[model samples]
Target: FLRAIGKARLITPLRSEGGHRRYSRYQLRIAARARELVDQGTPIEAACRIVVLEDQLEEAQRINAEYRRAAEQADPPPAD
Candidate 1:
């Protein structure tokens, strides 16, 4: 199913010297999420797409938070 997930673009595992797939901790987490979605009755393809979108949303939110913090630092409130 990892191959299927890779083909679906949910996770991209690295290849070992012998061409074996090697997943990082992050990728494993993605796989676990996919499994969770599947257990909830989501189709495999749909689960992969959801996971990818979820990861993208999380990254966007983190960046947005950082920007907000930096902006606050640059220009604090004018008065109490």
Candidate 2:
């Protein structure tokens, strides 16, 4: 099933010199979520799409938080 996911272009695991697929921690996490969705009756393709969107949202949130922190540091509120 992981091969299917990789074929779907959802998460591409690295190919080792020995031709084995190597998954990263992040990729494994994605695969776990996809499996969970499948267990809940979600179609594999849809599950992959949902997982990708979820990851994108998480990254966006993290970047937004960093920007907010940087702005706050650059312009500390005026001391009363």
Candidate 3:
């Protein structure tokens, strides 16, 4: 799939006798974000921009808070 999309260049290649591919954490993050954006109806170029330039820290925090609240609202563990 990566090769099909021409995103293989976004990843780093490992240097071996035959030159293998090795992706870094940053590359993986970019690919994941790209996939997410693509799933959300964003074009590849726009998705790359959002993933690379958009400040999503606040949104991430909000989502985390929502999840925490939901978890707290769930029933507690029963007595042993």
lDDT by residue (tens digit), candidate 3, 1-80: 34523453443445567776566676667688778888989877677667655546657888999998888779655779
TM-score, cand. 2: 0.91
Q: Rank the candidates by lDDT, best first.
A: 2, 1, 3
Report the error of model 1 at residue 60, Å.
0.9
Q: In TM-score terms, which candidate is top?
A: 2
Which candidate leads in lDDT?
2
On residues 44-79, what C-alpha lDDT tens digit does candidate 1 reach at each position? 999998998999999999999999999999999999
Residues 1-80, model 2: lDDT tens digits = 89988987888999999999999998998999999999999999999999999999999999999999999999999999
TM-score against truth, every candidate: 0.90, 0.91, 0.48
For candidate 2, give the lDDT of residue 49: 96
Better of 1 and 3 by lDDT: 1
Which window of ten consecutive residues has the lowest lDDT sum in model 3? 4-13
Is 1 or 2 the stronger prediction by lDDT?
2
Query: lDDT of each prediction vs. the true structure?
Result: 0.93, 0.93, 0.66
Please list the Cα RMSD from the true structure of every candidate, rounded to 1 decimal place: 1.1, 1.1, 7.9
Q: How accurate is candidate 2 locally (lDDT)?
A: 0.93
